[model samples]
Structure formats: structure tokens, C-alpha cells
Target: MPTLSMLYNTAIASAFVKILLFPCYRSTDFEVHRNWLAITHSLPLKEWYTSHISEWTLDYPPFFAWLEFTLSWIARLLGFDKAMLDPYNLNYVSTSTIVFQRSSVIVLELVLLYALCAYVRSMPARDQPNAILAAIDIFLSPALLIIDHIHFQYNGFLFGILMWSLVLAQKRETLLKSAALFAALLCFKHIYLYVAPAYFVFLLRTYCLSPSGYRIQFKNSIKLGATVIGIFLLAFGPWIYMGQMPQVFQRLFPFSRGLCHAYWAPNFWAMYAFADRVATFFLPRFGYSLPDAVNSALNGPTRGLVRDTVFTVLPNITPRLTFLITLFFQSLVLIKLFFRPTWRNFVGAVTLCGWLSYLFGWHVHEKAILIVIMPFGLLSLKDRRYLEAFRPLAVAGCISLFPLLFTPAEAPIKYLYTGLWVAILLKFNRAAPVPLKRQFLLTRVNLSYMAGFIPLLIYNGIVHRIVFGDRLEFLPLMLLSAYAAWGIFWSCISLIWLYFTDLD
Candidate 1:
């Protein structure tokens, strides 16, 4: 296990790297948060959600807006540039603005660092060393590097809260606090609704249900329900009092968005979209001309545009259908956790629930892969099989994030840094046992899947540009997304099978 001083020194090094990356590529998310600061600082409390001077309106839940509102005071009082708080200052990014915004992510990520330490400390003595490994890997996660620092979101801060909730759920005395923290997390960003079913089932089965028999713990159930409702009320109370609840809900859940983002998230839909493309266009080349509507194949879903998905050869996917599919798969994990709500099983259910949602959720952002990768880290240390499951996901999830840092200056950092992290994880993945033949077969298949990345990366970074230039600009993204989807799918299946059959 790493000594406390080692963890502190590593964190300092991570922060230094983040400071250097301040001048690196940042996404539109920079302006989004800057706009939030301005809106929260310059506007009245009543108009927080109503302001629309900038296109990046206040869409996050009330707690996050409140967080911004609180930070706005610090920005104003601390002598940072006050112009950054102008609601109409569209795309205003001065050096001070950049410093404040970037610095805020680095500092708030201390929350993530804290939560990881706490979770590691809370682990049983036998699991302490392995838990420390999870903490370190998650802290140094390539996904966080590309997505949070370069892409510029508060994901580290939010996921920190998630880790805290998970830690609390481990003990019976703190289960209510766990549920409350999770409820607050949802209000902070409802995307966490991905694992809501798991929490609900785990809390219901383990906490609210009598431990010995099937009798209901009505008093405990009411207490749990009230705690969750109270947290939501605290978050939404002001908006509800102003009678703008519908407005808040609309901004929070914009179903008007497309089935996928401009860049396909590396999940099931990426592969699904690819298959439709092949069936639509490739069939005609083999003299399988059937439908002229296939003429629209050129403008199909994988065009890398952010618009509602339209399928040419397959059934169109609606948000309703996606929700049902996500819920169905997540229900399987939840059912297992409902029966066996051990700490181990709960952690597995959380990871699988997030995986199912990311794979099947409508309009999933590629960054949501962190949802799978972070939670799965806890389970990976159990044995060789668990580490085997994590290996492909860690690799796929890491490489899928490479596209996020597409600038030449950031490419070396993502590639080398993520490469190092994966190597350390592979070393740690050692020491677990399996049958010789099964281990051999697994290693061979994993190596082959990983080997494909060489040509894929080469083609994406070099050959595609040399051959097609800007013509098929979206091809690289499609290839990366589809490839990662296969590996994540494999990991999810293996983990799910382990969850069902593995002894607690």
C-alpha cells in the first residue's frame, strides 16, 4: 500500500499537471460554466433558471446552480475579474476567467480525492491494500484527465459525492445517509439516475426489509422515504415556490436532444448505428437492392451530427424504448442485489447498473464511460477473474477518451499518460489464479482485441487524413466508438456473470 505521504505527493503532482494543462485545449464546457457563474452572480435568485442571455442556460439541478451562486461570491470577492459575471458576455474567456474556471476544477477535485481516501479507509482490513489501489487508479484516471481537465466539466466533484454515498452504503448505520446523499447527488445531476434502481433495491432489501423474514419495516421505510424527499425538497424548494418547476424540469431533461451526441459515445448504440450503415449501403453492392429509401443511407445516424436518430434498415429508437431497454438490463442487476445485498454484491450492482445505462441510455455522452470505469475499480481487486473483466474496460474506456483530446499538443499526454496508467493496472492485475487453459484463452482473446487498436489508431490519426482528408471526417470517431463498444460489452457480460455466480 502507498503511504499517506505518497498519496499526498501524488495528488500534488496531479494538481501540478492540471495547472500546466490550463493552457491546453478546453471544450465548450468552459464557457458553459463561465456562463453559469455570470448568470448566478448577476441575476436575481428568482431569475436563475429564467435567464437566457446565453445559449448555455442554467440546466443543471438547483444544487449545482446554488454551488455556482456560492462560488460567484468567492470569485467576486477574491478580486478575480468581475466582467466574467456579466450575463450577456457571450464566450467571454479572459486569462483570469480561464484561471478561475480551470483552477476551480482542480480544487474541487480535492473532493474526489477526499472521498477516495475515505472509501479506502472504510474498507475492511483485508481489503485495504486493494482498495487503496482502486483509489489511486481512479484518482489518476485517464478519463478524468481528458474529460474533466481538458473537456472541462465538474464530473470529478460529482463523482466524488457518488463515492461518498457508496462508502456510506457499506454500513448499516449509515444506509439512510447513503440514500440521502444519493438523492442529493441525483438532484445535483440526474444522469446519476442510471443507478437509482440499484440503490432503491439495495436499500429496500437490506435496510427496509426485515433481515430474518419477509416482513416489512414500515417505520424504517417511512424514515428512508422522508429523508430522500426532504433532500429533493431542499434542492427544488425555491423553484417550486416560484412555480417554475416545469421550466426547471424541461431544462434538466431535454428529450429534444438526439439519440447520440455529435461524437458517438462508445456504447451499444455506436455499434448499432454501424450495423445499420452496413446493411443499408453494403447490401446494394452485393446486388441485394431492395428499398430505395436506403438512398438516405448517406445521411444516416453515424454522420457525427447532433440530431435525432433516423434508421434506414432498422427500427427507429425512441427515448421510451431506450429507457425500457436500460431499465430491463438494470433490473437484472438490481434483482441480484435485492437477493444478495452484500457489500460486494451492491458494488457489483452499482457498476453493472451504470454500465447498462451507459450502453443503452439515450443521448449518452462519451464521458459517461467514467460511470462504468470508476465503480468497476472497486470490484477488480477481488481475484484474477475480476481483474480480467476490468482489463478490457480500463483499456477501452481509456482509449475512447483519446478523441476528447484531439489537439496535437494534448495527444502525447493522453496517449503516454493513459498508457502508463493501464500498465500499472495490468501489473496489479497479476497474482490472481484461474485454470491454465481458461487463463490462456482469456489472455489470447484480450491481446487480440487490444492489438486491433494499433491499426485503428494509426488509421485514425494518420492514414484517414492522408487518404480522405476532410471528406469522411466522421469515420475515425465511428471506428473508435464501435471498437470500444465491443470491449465494454465484453466486460459487462463477464462482470454480470461473475456477480451471479461468484460466492460472497
Candidate 2:
């Protein structure tokens, strides 16, 4: 039998194979990007508003506008004409639009890929290369590659910069470079702003909490501030100069006036919506009248008289409302990081809380999966005190992948990515260099979280039928239930363990 290390390395290699080969699965929603390309490429700079795309595309961080603008130039070169493009019928499959768009996203991912590889290469020699490689393999695998490059949006570029900056911070070198990268990430996607608290904690410890004991070093703070300002100006200057500030805001924060997407992903928000319906059905003690139902515009094989029993206390709860609520929960996680400031505790809380927010929010896209899984990287790299905590994080990350595979969503290669996660978790558990006591703890905690899924699966697959009058329909809901429950439950377990044990 190959050593676990060799197996881990092989898994990593296989993951890369999947990423490179998986065909982009085009969705009806891809019209949004097509419309964006049409607007950016063909329209006069001032006329871009009339050709405005989906609201989601509008609210991206400012750096992405520059990216879109830059890509638009190439799209124009490739015969992209806004006059010929119809925003109402922008399905990528109908035109060459998707190919160019996906190509642009793939190029962006290479930046993330390079940053990720650089960070991995910087890992301490004492750690398991096999496990690190396995984890990285999972990150670069087909699921992430396809979701980022084809189906969803361009998040990898920003995420890449963030991770690279984080690694630089961890290494305590080139704080200015790290700050610049951090600003660039924020400029690309504002959603990542939720995790800024953790970044602040990282900078404080690595730079200000000097090895020189007592004296406070104020110079690093100035360098950090100046770097942040420099990058923010550099990224935003062009848009500001274009006199597109108003247009930019309209795009970046165009909150939809709706409760949920036509198709709800298996996530926390779905469960919460379900629970809200059940609550209103069983007990309306507060004079809560159910709101008008929003139709999903269903027209397919699965289309029928599908009834959502979800009740709303507030009749006009939109995506913006849910986003605000999610932001509130995210604040709690940030507060936890603020008080504790340890990488292990901080990263875990952010992962759990950030995921919980995304899971329950309205108009959620499957692309939101990254918010939950990305934190696992930090969790993996932090103190060994986190190994037990991270076991569940890894399991959750793997489970999150299942919904993408075998589902109607494009990018079928997600199965390979899912397999990579399984392989990494298994290999990490087996090949850890620590004592049996620590290893057993990690394994036990992982089992505890993984086992919790059984009840969740049963609830979604069968019990949801009893409760909601639909059995098979709620399978996706069940997956989300399992994910949300495990995240919250295991986090409690980790905190308790941290409190009692000498994790140091």
C-alpha cells in the first residue's frame, strides 16, 4: 500500500486533473454575466447604465468594475456588440458570450492559483506536506475551478489576493505587500469585508505584538495604513475619474426587492424560512398573518403545484433585509474574534458565522459556498489546537460539495472536487504527526460532527414530508440542515474544548 503521504499527493494530482477538464456548466442565470459583458464592452462609457446587467453584477467591489472594463476591451475586440446583444435573452449557451466570459474568469483564477501555491510553498517544513498538499488540492479542485470560472462569478481573483496576503501576514514579512493585497481583495468584492476583523487580528499579532516583548512598535501601523490607502486609491481612481461613482454604487449594491431566489439552495436560510412557516402554521400568537406567496416562475419537468409553506411576519422582506440580518450575525462572529484574537478561535467563529449568514440570507446563490469553505484553510493552518475543530470543518466543506454534484447545476466535475475533499480529510486524519491522544481527539470530534448528519438527513429525506407534506422535494433542504447544524454544533464543542483543555 502506498504511504498515506503518497496517497495524499496522488489525490492532489487527481484534483488538478478534474479542474482542468471539467466543462463549464451553463445556467439560465449566466445571462446576467452576458448582459454585463454586453454593457461593459459595447456601450459608450456613459451609456453603460441603459445596458445595465443583473443587480448581482452591479454590487461587486470596485476593482471588479476595472476588471470588467478591461475584459470588455477584449470582448469588443472579439466582435462583441451591445447593439446585437439582448439583455432579456442573454443565456450563454445561445452565443459566444459565455466562452469569452468563462475565459476571462479562468484567467482571473490563475492569479488566485499562483497566490495559493505561493502560500502553500511557504508552509513550515515540519508540517505534513502530504496533508497541506491534500488540502490545497481540494481548493484547486474542479468544484472551485468550475464554479468560479464558469457558472457563478469571478471571486477567485479577490480570494487569491486575500489568501496570499494572509500567508504573508502569517510569515511576518512584507506587511506593506500584505496590506496592499488585502485592499485589493476588498476592492474586488465587498462581501469579504465581513472577515476583515480576522485580518485585523492577524496584523495585530504578527506585527504589533512584537517578539521584543514590552515596547509597542508604531511604525508597522503607519506602513499598514499607508499601504491600504495607496491601494484603495489606485484601485478606485479610474472609476472616480470616469465620474461613474453613482453608477458604480448602483451596480455594487443593487439589493433585490425579494425574499429568496426562485430556487432555494440547501442552506440555512431555507431551513429558517421553513421553520418560519411551521411556526406561523402552528402558533400565530402574535397576530402574524402570512404574507403573499412569491411565485418561482416554474416551467420544467419538476414544475408543478409546488407550495412553499414558509411564512413571513414582515410582508416585504427583501434580499437586502436578509442581508442586514446576516450582517448582524456576522457581527457577533467578529465580536468573538475581537475578544479572543487567537487564530484558531477567530477563524473558526468567522467560518461558522459567515456560513450561517450566507445559508439563511435571501437571494442566495450556490456561489456563496465559498464563504463557508474558504475559512477552512485558515483553520487548517492555525494552531494544532484547531485540528479537532477543523476535522468537522473539513467534513462540512466536503458535504457542501455534494449539492453541486449530481444536481442540475452545470460543472459536473464538482464530483471530483468533492472526492478530493474526502481524500484530504481522510489523509490528514491518518497521517498527522501528533501523538495518539491528539489524533484520537481529532478523529472523535470529526466523527461526532459527521454523525450528526444522520439525523439531519433523516429529517430532510423523510421527516420533512411528515412536517411539510413533501418528502423527496426537501432533500436539498436536508443537506443544508446538516451543514448548518454541524457548523453551529461543532463550534460549541470546539469552544468548550478550548476552554477546558490546554490547547496551547
Candidate 3:
């Protein structure tokens, strides 16, 4: 059995390592948060959404804005107002800025620590050790380290709240609490909107309605309705009252950016974009006629962040199409959850929802892979099949995040740290035994895929630059994204198959 002290020691060790990275590279997100602090602290409430003083205008949901507001006081107490929090202090990098911003992420990560200890405590005695391993895996996650401590974001803090909510997901008594916490999480970051369907189906089926039948439980139903309404009212009430809700909505859900992020998240679309790129090259040589627009699209997807996610030889993807595709896959597991309505199935539904949306959602960030991995960690030890399903995603999804920290300085950090994380945690997270032949096949498949990474990483990290110095610069990203997508898609489908067939 794990104690609170040991779990927090894990958090503390991770926190110390995070602080060591304070002097390392910080992304544009550093400035983005700094500007948000300025907007919330200096500007009036009505102007929080309207402030265009910086290019990093406040685009996150209101609770996050409020979080920045709460942190701004600490930043002010640190005497970083002029150098860090001022919207006009664009790209300022003083010692005070580093201390304030980096320390804030480290401090906020305590929420994750709190969640880990509580989650382990909530588990049965036999499960506590495995839960501790999951907690360590999350804290030591290479992607989380790169994105939060180095690339710089509040993802740790946001995910901390999400972990707390998932802890409530495990018990029959705490289902409504889970729903309320998840609602507040959506308020903190609208990115959680991708998984809202799972929560909706789980709560409505398992909590709001009578478990034995479809008849509504008015008390539970009313409580859920009130919680959802009350949370949204707190997050959006001010803007709605001031007639600026449209503007906030526009900022929050700006679908105009493109189908994929500038750094392509490895998903169905990554594979889609790769196929389109390949077809654009070879299709013209086969005596196929090409449109003028498509002829010019040879470099469109690789060229970065254009208005449309153009494809030369394939149909262009619209936001609506991605939405429909996402919704369709979401319903498959959701329908299963509705039928089963068990805690194990509910957690699996959440994992599939997060995984599928990350796999198919419009304008997904590479960092969103954490959404899939974090919730899935809860279910990874449930059975031999669950562990088998997890190994693929845990390996592939972390590799998909490699591109996000592609700078030479951080490359070794990602590769080496992620390698050790996998070595330690996967070895520790044992599950119930399976048939010998099945386990043998699973081991071989895992070994083959894991071995493939050695060549892929070395080639991309070292050989690619030597071979194609700055020319064909996008090829490495394209190859890595496509390579990782296969594993991600395999894991999603395997877990879905499990949910439909063996969801006891």
C-alpha cells in the first residue's frame, strides 16, 4: 500500500527536476500567459476578452483567465509587473520572469500530486501499488515535462483538475461529484470539450436515469442539470450579461485556424495528409488531370498554418466533416457505456472519447495525447487485455509528442527521459495473466514496434539533418507523424473492440 508521503515524494522529485529546467527554452506560450496576466490584472473586466494589446490575446475559457488573474497577484508580489505581466513587455526574459512563470507551473502541479495520493488511497489495497506506478508515470511523463516545464503551458495544472475528476469516476457513490468536477474542468479549458460526449453519456445513463430502466431519476437529473448550468453560469455569466458572449465564443472556438495544428498531431488526419502529399506527387505522373488549385497545393500542407488545410489530390477537410467523423466514433463507445453503465466501462468510454477525439478532432495539438494517456492509466491494470491495449498508446503517443520539442537542445531530453520512463513504468504495471500464445504474440508485436523506434529516432534526429540540411525540412515531421499514427489508431480500435465485446 502507498502512503500519501511516498506519492508526494514522487511529486516533489518531479517538481525539483522541473525547476532545473527553468533556464531552458521557453515557447511563445510563456509570453501568452504573461500577456493574459496583464490583461486580467490591468484591464477592466469587460475588456478581458477584447484586449488586443498583444497578439496572444486571451483565447482560453474564463476559468483559465481567472486562474491567470489569481496568479497575477503572486506575480505582482514578486515585483514582475512591469517586466513580466505588462502586455507591452513583449518577450521579456528577466530572472524574475523565469522565477515567477516556471515556479507557478511547479507549484500548480501540486494539484496533480494531491490527485495522485487521493486516487491511490481510493483504490483497494492490492491496486494501490499499481496506482502509485501510474501516478509516477504521469508525473514523469516525457510529454508533460517537455510541454509544461520546457515548452511552457499550464497543461499540468489543467490536467491536475482533470485527474481529480477522474478519481471521482471510480466509485458508485461519487458519480455526481465526478460530473460536477468534469463540468468545472471544461470551464477551465475548452479543450476538454472533445471528451464532453463521454461524460454526457456516462452521467445521463449511469447517474441521471434509473440504473435498472430508462426512467429518469428526477433528483439526480435535476442535480446534474443544476451543476452544468451553474458552472457555465459562473464561467460565462459576466460576458453574457455584458453582451460579449459572442465575442468570447468566437475567441474560445476559433475554427478558422486550420484542420491540423502547425505541428501536425499524429492522428487519422496526419495519415490523411500524408496520403494526400504522396498522391500529389505520384498522381500527376499517371496521366491524371489536375485542377489548378491542386497543382499549386503540392507544398500547402507542409508549408505551415495556412487558412485551409488544402490537399492536392484529395478532398479538402472542413471543420464540420471532422466534427461528424469525431462524433460517429465517439458514439460507438458511448453507446456501449450507455448499455453497460459500469465504472470500468465508464472509464474506458472516457479514454476512447479522449483518444478518438485526439485521433480525429479538428485542430488538435500534439500535447492533447496526454488526455488519452492520463485517463487510460486508470484502466491499464484492469486486465491483461487492458495492459496490452495500453502499451501501444503509451509508446506511440509519447513519440508523437517528440516533434513538439524538436529543438536540438531538448531532443536528448525527450528521447532519453521517455525511454527510461517506458522502461520503468511498463515493467512495473503488471496485469492479470493471459494465454501463453496470446502473450507471446503481444510481446513480439510490442518488441517489433519498439525496436522500429531506434532507427526512426536516430535517422530523424541525426541522419536527416546530415542528409537534407534545411532542404525538405518538413519530411522528418511528416514521417514521424505518420509512423506514430498507426500505433495510435491500433490502440483506439483495440480498446473499442474490448469495450464492445468484453465490457464486464
Candidate 4:
């Protein structure tokens, strides 16, 4: 097993790399956090959710607002301009501001580092290979580097909390603590709601009710219910007392956004949109003249607007339909957990639930792919089949995030770092004695698909500009989304098949 000193050194090395990226390209999320710092610092609790000074309002839960409020004080003490704290100071940027915000991300990632060490320590010696590989994979994940370090967000911190919850939930004695931690996580960021059903079903089956039989334990059920309710109350109690529940909820779940983001997430919806585009293009050759309304609806997805998408070639997908599809897939996994109620099964279900939501949920951001990928690290450790599924999924998912850091300076860094990480993953898998079969066809197919990214990246980054340029501005994004969606969609099906046939 790797020693504590080795793990600590690994963390130090990773932190050093993150520090070097302090001045890399940052997305508007940098401004969004700064705006959040200002709002949380200057405004009252009641105004936290209601303030619309910037388009990026306080959409995260109240606990996160409180966290930002706490950080603002430290930022102020570090010589950050107080004027930047003003709610109306939109697009404010300064060196001190950049240092404070970027440093905060680096500092908070320590939580993830700590949680990873704890997880590695908790695993048995026989499982050490998988655990160590998972830790390294997550630490060097291109998605984390892109989304958190460059694109700028607090996902690492939030996912750290999630890791602790998952680790705690594995043991029967710590189930209640896990529940409380998960409740707190949801209060911190409601995006974790994607995996809530797995947590709920697992806790209900294994803790509140009998695992082997269908008898409810009234006392345990009440205790679990009260514990969850109490955490939520602590998070929202102040707002509730001020009668701001509706406003808080509106900020939390804004159905007004759209069916797809400006860049469609690599998901089922992306594939659906792609198919619609193909049908619209070729159907005219078959002498089918669609109405103007139908053509207009079909054109919306191609334009990549941030409003509700209409399908000209197919039925328009409503938020309700997306919700139902998500629920149906989630239920399939949750039902499996209800019967099995084992720790491994619970982890698998959590991974599946995340995959379902990311694939079919309405308005999913590409960054949300982390929800599926992170838990998948856990599942991959237990089975080679999961590792197989993860290979393609991770490759495609990381590549799909390339568009986020499109600047010339950061482009080489993203690719080189990702290549290094993939090399490490491959080396570790080769060294591990997992008895993985060497399937020539499967290996060739995966390699071929992964290699396709070379051409895809070239076209999107260079060839597109040389060819159509601004005339076909959305073409690259559309192609990237559709291509990545196919890979992820196939991986999802492969995992589902493994769950039914191989998982016990």
C-alpha cells in the first residue's frame, strides 16, 4: 500500500499544478462567483435569493450563500476592494479580486484532497489498487481541471462533501451520519439532487426498513426523517421564517431556462437534436414541404439558443416529459437497490441515477457530467466491466469539455494534461492484476473512437475557422455534442447491461 507520506506528496504535487493555473483562462463563472461574493456580503438574507443585479443570481442553496458570505470577510481582509462587494458592481475584475477568487478554489480543493486520502485509507489492502487508481484519476481529471480551475466553479469542494457522504454511507453504523451529510450536501448545491433517489432508497431500505424483509422500523424511520428535516430546516429556516420559500425555490429550480443550454450537453437530447437536424435537411429531397412553423421550430436547436427548444422533425419535448424520462430510468436503478440494499449496489445505483439525469434531464450543463463520472470512479473500482465502460465515457466526456476553454493559450494545456492523465490511467490498469480479458475487436473499436477525437478537435479548433468560419459558427459545437453524445450514450447502455448481467 502507498504510505501516507506518498499520498501527501501526491496532493502537494497536484496543488502545485493548480497554483500554476492561477492565471489561466477563466470563464464568466469567475465573475459569477465574484458577483455571488458581493451579493452574499452586501445583501440581507431575504435579498440573497431575490437580488437580480446580475444575470447569474444566487441559484445555489442558502448554505452555499452563507459559505460565500463567510469567504467575503476573508477576501476583504486580504485587501480586496470593498467596492467589488457591491451588488451592482457587474463584471468587476482586479488583481486582488482574481487572487482572492482563484486562491479560494485552490484552498477549498484541499477538502477534496483530504476526502480522497480518507477514502484510500479506508479501503482494504486487496482493494488498494482500485482505490489508488480512482484517487489519481479524480485528482488529475481533465473535467475537474477544466471546470474548476480554468472555467472556475466550486464543484471540487461540493464533490468533496459528496465523497465523504458516500464513504460514510457504506457502513451500517454510519448510515445516519451519511444521511445527515447528504442532506447538508443538497442544501449546499441542489444539483446533487440527481443522485438523491439512490440515497433515499438505500437509506429507506437498509436503515429505516428491514434489508432482508419488508417490515418498517418506526423509530429508525422517524429518527432518519427528523434528522434530514432538521438539516434542511437549518439551511432554510431563516428564509422560511421570513416567508421567502417561494422565492428561494424559484432560484433553486428555474424551469424558465430552456430544454438545452447554449452548448447542448453530450446527452440523449443532443442526439435527438442531431437526428432532427438530419431529418430536416434530407426530408426536403423527398418532396416534403413542411409548414413555416415546423421549420421555425426545427431551426431553433441548430441556432443553439438558450430558450425552450422546439423540434420541427419530432414532437417538442417539454420539461415535464424530460422529468418523466429521468424518473423512469432512475426508478429502474432504485428498484434494484430496494431489493439488494448492499453497499456496492447502492454505489452502482447512485452512478446509474447520475447517468440517467445527465442523459435525459432538461437543461443539463456539460459540467454536470462530473455527477456521473465521479461516482463512476467508485463503481469502476469494483468491476472490470465498469472500468471498460468508464474508459470511453471518460475520454468523450473530457473531450466534450474542450469547448469551454477555447482560448489558444489554454488549449495545449488541456490536451497535454488530459493525455498525461490518460497515460497514467492506462499504465495503472496494465499493472493491476484484474484478469481483464483482451478482446481485439472491443479494443480496436474503443481505440478507433478515441482516435476520432483527433480529427474532431482539428476540425473544431482549426479547420472550421479555415473553411466556413463565422458562417457556420454553430457547426462545430453541434458536431462535438452529437459525437460525444453517441459515445456517452453507448457507455450508458453498456453499464446498464453490466448491471443486469454481471453485478451481483
Note the Cα lDDT for every prediction shown: 0.86, 0.55, 0.81, 0.85
lDDT of 2: 0.55
Clashing pairs in 3: none
State the lDDT of candidate 1 residue by residue for 361-428, as single tens digits. Answer: 99999989999988888777777788888889989998998987888998889888987987788788
lDDT of 3: 0.81
Whole-structure CA lDDT of model 1:
0.86
Give per-residue CA lDDT, model 2, range 1-504, as digits (tens). Answer: 223355345545644653453355654435565666555655565555434444424456556655777776777667755442444444434445655666666567656666666655665565546435534644554446555544556767666776677556554567667767877888877776656656775566556666545345789777877778888888767667878778767766545323444344445554555455445445546675434322211221112223332344323355556667767766665555555555455446556555656555655554565765665555553445455565565555445444443344532345445555555555554444454355324555567666776576556545776886753474454446446545644544564455334343
- After TM-score superposition, what is the CA distance of residue 233 in candidate 3 from its true location, in Å? 0.7
Candidate 2 TM-score over all chains jointly = 0.71
Off by over 4 Å in 1: 290-295, 431-441
- Candidate 3 deviant stretches above 4 angstroms: 1-5, 291-295, 429-441
Give model 4's TM-score versus the native structure. 0.96
Model 2 misplaced stretches (Cα beyond 4 Å): 1-24, 47-50, 53-57, 75-89, 92-99, 128-131, 140-146, 204-219, 238-247, 255-271, 280-366, 381-388, 395-420, 435-504
For lDDT, candidate 1 versus 2, the one ahead is 1
Residue 1, model 2: Cα distance from true site in angstroms? 14
Off by over 4 Å in 4: 1-4, 293-299, 435-441
| Span of 10 residues, lowest total lDDT, candidate 3 | 432-441
TM-score of each: 0.96, 0.71, 0.95, 0.96
Q: For every candidate structure, what is the RMSD over all alpha carbons to the true structure, in angstroms? A: 1.9, 6.3, 2.1, 1.9
